[model samples]
Target: MKARFPDRAKLRAQVWNAMDNNPGTRMPAFGKYQALSEAEIDAIVDYLYTL
Candidate 1:
């Protein structure tokens, strides 16, 4: 099967952007998450790799 997120860096960027920007209809903008730092976001991305 095709991969959901083939590029980790791209995925991280998308996630960070989604925090303030609306990605799509399925998910709403999570502006509150903007408080998270780049390191925190990287940690999140690292966790996602496990899934």
Candidate 2:
């Protein structure tokens, strides 16, 4: 979710935090992503930034 926003690091951190918090159906639970490693998460974040 690319936005006109300036802080990619902050945005990335928010995503990571949300994943850790597991906020139910409001977003996907991070546990479903246990198979993914930190590098995979970084790659996903990088791709989102390109949008």
Provide the TM-score for each candidate, comma-separated: 0.60, 0.50
Model 2: residues >4 Å from true position, as ranges? Answer: 19-25, 29-35
Give the per-residue Cα lDDT of candidate 2 at 31: 30
lDDT of 1 by residue, 1-51 (tens): 017778786677666665333445354232235657778778878888888
Candidate 1 stretches with Cα past 4 Å from truth are 19-33
**Local distance difference test, each candidate:** 0.62, 0.60
Residue pairs clashing, model 1: none
Using TM-score as the measure, the top candidate is: 1
lDDT of 2 by residue, 1-51 (tens): 656536776555545555544445366433345645667767877888888
The deviation in Å at residue 11 for candidate 2 is 2.1
User: What C-alpha lDDT, on a 0 to 100 scale, does residue 36 get in candidate 1?
Assistant: 70
Most lDDT-accurate candidate: 1
